[model samples]
Target: MNHLIRIIAISFVLMPPVFAQKLVDPAAVAPEYRDAAEHRRTEQLRQRACSLKAQQAKILLRDRAAFVLKCMDAADASK
Candidate 1:
């Protein structure tokens, strides 16, 4: 019984790292964003997108893709 308790304690201690990892969304990501580096690149793109999008006075919520595309184009242009 003590052995069972020790095993359970060890399992609990070991499990948090597995469970604490971030969950990536497949559909929300583009194909090029599979790597961690690519994902980090998109954060800058998103920030640029937001700033560019904020400049427009009449941007509809449904038209966010336009901002993302423009941001991606800007990133590509810089590269």
Candidate 2:
């Protein structure tokens, strides 16, 4: 049990340096790559917003058509 505990403690100390070396700081990324990444993100957001707006417009048109049909039904019923 003591040997196992020592092994675990040694591993805990050694693991951090190995993992730390793999980390990439965002500021270290090259400028052209960062700019391209930002542009892609912005374009993706714009496309999503446009898609949502189009969906909303379709829903509004469907509702307007339903309202018009209801009015027509009322007119026909009154006659």
Candidate 3:
């Protein structure tokens, strides 16, 4: 019983790192498609960042969608 408990505790401790890791692995894609895959991953990450910014600024739900789009476009414009 003690061994089982220890294993369970260890599993819970290790689970977060697995979950926190990036969802997409561009290298896992075919070489010919890797660039496109990376671009998609970057766009998703950018969108999430914009959403987080909106949340931090307390932007309302109705306004958030537009704010996120504008934020992403601004980021693209700067790049």
Candidate 4:
């Protein structure tokens, strides 16, 4: 009863995270769309760079998203 409930709760808590999106493989895409795939890869790199900057700056979790968004926008605007 109680033991079973505890085990269930523990299992749920320990479960690995599941990502909703799958990574795009550029090689798997058609040659015509390779440019689009490259763009996606570049955006992913930009996002990872922003995330690293946020972590290095020790941004609060609440403000980190906004910070990243602003960073990305700034990057795009400069292009």
Give the 10-residue window scoring lowest on summed lDDT in candidate 4. Answer: 19-28
Best by TM-score: 4
Give the per-residue lDDT digits (tens) of candidate 1, residues 5-63.
99999999888554533445555686776676556656755665565764664567677
What's the alpha carbon RMSD for model 3?
Answer: 6.0
Query: How well is each residue in 1-79 modelled by candidate 2, as lDDT tens digits?
Result: 9999999999998885543223234455787587666666655554545545556666575565555455445555787
Worst 10-residue stretch by lDDT in candidate 1? 17-26
**TM-score of each candidate structure, all chains considered together:** 0.32, 0.34, 0.65, 0.71
**Weakest 10 consecutive residues of candidate 3 by summed lDDT:** 16-25
TM-score of 1: 0.32
**Against the unseen true structure, what C-alpha lDDT does each candidate score?**
0.67, 0.59, 0.90, 0.91
Off by over 4 Å in 4: 13-23
lDDT score, residue 65, model 2?
53
Give the candidates in order of TM-score, highest first. 4, 3, 2, 1
Error of 3 at 31 (Å): 1.6
The residue pairs in collision within model 2 are: none
